[model samples]
Target: MADEPDPQLSVPVGMFEDIEDLKATNAALIAEVKALAAQVTALADGGGADPGEALGGDEAAAGGEPADEGEAEAEQYPPFILLLDSPAYDDELRALIEWVEGVLVPGYLAEPSADARWCHLWFEHPVAVARLHAAWLAWQELTDPASCGYTGPSVWHRDHLDPALRELRASTGPFAGCTKGEHQVGHRLPGLVPSAWTHGDD
Candidate 1:
């Protein structure tokens, strides 16, 4: 109406709007890529991803289960101590002992009795060491707040702790014939019959 609005200028105005829209889209895409990169970096560094930001709000809200499960899955756990070699195994065992004496024994173990035996030299017995190490590893995983959450300890007790204690403290368990103060000095593993291939017609 106002002098026909200058037809040539109209095209430029429309093009300008399109360019602005494209710029906004590009900025949003860049932000998303940056966020993804940050998450990857965190995971590589053994630092777990942030739950709220990792999956985005809409996806997280859509399904509550994935986010909750992802928290534990994202955590990195150490390898079994028995799998390690020489000094590493020795080093880990020392730390394991610290946890056993400081946290495990004091908090969980019962008084030594004829039916429920214990040994001060439990480490001397390979089977006892293996069992305790397994329990200790489970303890580390379940007790972590970032991994197992609130129900971890209860689960550990039911699935790991009780079973190990039953075997370790039983009258005929690894500490058999051993007492709290007096470790059974001559404890020996039961002998196994030789294989036919090795002792053939001897």
Candidate 2:
């Protein structure tokens, strides 16, 4: 006898209906998300009226200052106070401070102009000059091994053992990446050498 055909073989219509329903639901969810995103962006760009005012909160304040005493009290630390007070010589003063950090401390010497402006270019801005003085003291404290020995003073030894002059010369070796026309700002001297240097052993 021939093999009988099997019966009850059928595609699940309910599964396809459920899948179609899920796709519709997913598309509706995506559209709703897009609309919510647009509303958030509109709120951010100040397109609509103030919601905070309607809600009766601090965000409605017109001025950008702190809303409460606690918020005002939080802003005690200001890094740019000196710069704002004395903006004129800020750049030169910053350069001078950086030079002292990179050159003078490594050379085991203090800036000659502890009180005067002969060494530093900008003496006019008192704030900048004062910051330079503070930087010098900080540099001294940082480079001294004893001052910060408890805080792992490896950096102190590194700077002290290798003098800045020697460090400059060392940068020209095969392993060193220095090239012609690549002058480092820290080592440049503005004035002419003294005449006493012409004598062999003064």
Over 28-79, each residue of candidate 2 has an lDDT whose tens digit, in order, gives 6666556556557779998964554332232223223334554567665333
List residue ranges in candidate 2 displaced over 4 A.
1-46, 49-71, 79-108, 111-202
List per-prediction Cα lDDT, in the order shown. Answer: 0.76, 0.45
Model 2: how far is 82 from its true place, Å? 4.6
Candidate with best lDDT: 1
**Candidate no. 2 TM-score:** 0.21
Mark the regions of model 1 whose C-alpha exceeds 4 Å error after superposition. 1-76, 190-202
TM-score of each: 0.55, 0.21
Cα RMSDs, all models: 14.4, 18.8
Q: Residues 91-165, candidate 1: write the lDDT tens digits.
A: 988988898899988998888888777888887776787788899989888999798999999999999999999
